[model samples]
Target: MTAVGVQPSAVGRGDVVLRADGLSKRFGGLLAVQNVSFSQYDGEILAVIGPNGAGKTTLLNLLSGVYRPSSGRLHLLGRDVTQEPMEARCHAGLGRAFQIVRPFPEMTVHENVTVGALFGTRGTTLGQARERAYDLLERTGLAAHADKEAHELTLLQDKRLEVARALATQPRVLLLDEVMAGLRPGEAQEAVGLVRSVRDSGVSVLFIEHIMPVVRDLADRVVVMDQGQVLAEGTYHEVTANPQVVAAYLGTEEGLHA
Candidate 1:
């Protein structure tokens, strides 16, 4: 396998990994994401947060090439991948874990992740890909269940498997959609630790999460959305405390307290 060069700065503690400029998407008459713009620096965990229908998922879809943008551009490590197909983007080092975990029920956990390694990056032998897949499974703590059928796994394990599959692709940038939604509080903390470990391993993460506490604890920066537009962007405390953000999404004091 040919190694993709990592810049010294990017290998350092901080560097810009992904950037979006005026990215937008529409579905029929509905505009799901409108001129959204943001940048995720290398080694940082950037969180996208909003109430339901705020277009967080849609924005991710555009970034991941699941949906083409109606306007604007997407740059991954300074490359314009706005119109690139999903496979092409994956080859370019973009990886995504879906909000809805979709594992091949009949396949073993190891087989499922091995598929990602086979197709992702440039190319490699089946043996090499399987080796990489096993390493990813171990990193994501799914090694114990590698031989089990995907359908036999619990919800939390399924989530970990989704992440493990994405990691098998050797992505430089990963988009995680609600990996913590159904996890218990303790489980959520463990997932956060895994995310931190992924960043420590040189992969940058942009995640959409609804759980406020997890977002507050994990994100280096937070971007809030409302009605498909950015309502606020800042640190977790700054964005949550913004009056406009509260009014637009969190509602009144009673609403927030509710």
Candidate 2:
């Protein structure tokens, strides 16, 4: 995997890990995402951002196989996966963490993560899965709370558990949807570090985020969407500076600071 610090083009055209080609999703008459396309390179953190209902989550759903595209194609590590189901996509190295953290309330944190490890890619023995789950708990800072019930955690801890569960799947490209939504600034900063660590481990991350500062800090590239269409794509500074992107977010790029 290439380092995140390098320009994406520097990785060469062949390094594309996840590719979306004219992807769209529709519910009756509503076209949630329309002809959206982008590429996430090896070891890059790419952010998708827009106002509420801009179809960021819908696009993520399309990527993760939560919804098959109404039209167009999706490629994971160069394999066509447009028609695959969620489990198949997971097997193809796609992982997702939803904005709403939904741990099994009755399960211990360790058990919650254990389920992921055991079921993710298939093939691990029970013992190996248990061991991997424990390691992920430690890596995600949930080791101390491993024995605690999932419902006993703070919001931030729950968020970490969400991420840890996803990481247990060992995805090559992890899709995170608003993972930092309800976090305090300090907690968000910590989450930023965690995301960086994930990228450092060679996972290409494509995330949907509403928080601008978090996007600026974590994303090697930004994809801006508005009213179900991609408005712009570039580095944080470049996209935020785009007139169309600024207007879509609300008048000026400074609006992101709000």
Candidate 3:
């Protein structure tokens, strides 16, 4: 697919899909995210990266309504949704996958995905939802394990299940938090391809990842955060080559910038 053009004003407009401004969150004395601002255009993969405590996950939490920002403005599809609850955010077309897999251990893969279908972007009848869930499983290469208990799947399969479940919600923009964390090299590549396919299907993606290669391969733009604020924002090459990013986060490790 061709790269989309950048429109600064359109980014925060109602049609922009998702926008964050001066977003911050605090827990007691620790400031998780501080005055961070950015926007995700429709049908684009925007990757968020930083060092271990740079607040990447905290930013995702605030955007998805998992944790309300201490002070900030959040807009989804042009509506002021900063104070919306998690469920309301989900209904507003926000889907998320946790860094730690959270599928129901006792439920079948299909069943778990069905919960998303029932409560996701496009609500469907049971039959339609089942068909959609199966299609999503097939797309993610998990069709054979549809009937398997969630706990019985391998780590890679478990991660794919999380993606499928999020897809089942029919979100307009999906927030993936380290879905590629534990995968081997080959597996990570395959997962990256799957994410590209997701974006091609017209859903936007905002991903937080530590694997630099995956970020380079999947993101149309990269946003770097450090010390609770945006440290840099640009294409993969620009962000990686930024001196501040290298010294503070990328370091001299080749793998960190892969």
RMSD of each candidate relative to the true structure: 5.5, 3.9, 3.5
Write model 2 residue lDDT over 101-144, tens digit each, in one string.
Answer: 99999999999999999889688888888899999999999999
- Model 3 ranges with Cα > 4 A deviation: 1-15, 121-123, 253-258
List the pairs of residues colliding in candidate 1. 15-42
Q: What is the per-residue lDDT of model 3 for residues 179-203, given as tens digits with 9 covering 90 to 100?
A: 9988999989888988999988888
**How does residue 161 of candidate 1 score in lDDT?**
94
- Candidates 1 and 2 compared by TM-score, better number: 2
Q: What are the Cα lDDT values of the candidates?
A: 0.86, 0.87, 0.87
Candidate 1 RMSD to the real structure: 5.5
Range of the 10 consecutive residues with the lowest summed lDDT in candidate 3: 1-10
lDDT of 1 by residue, 142-211 (tens): 9999999999999889999999889888899999999998888888889999999998898999999877
Q: How well does each candidate superpose onto the true structure, as a TM-score?
A: 0.92, 0.93, 0.92
Q: What is the lDDT of residue 143 in candidate 3?
A: 94
Clashes of each: 1, 0, 1
Residue 165, model 2: Cα distance from true site in angstroms: 0.4
Model 2: what TM-score?
0.93
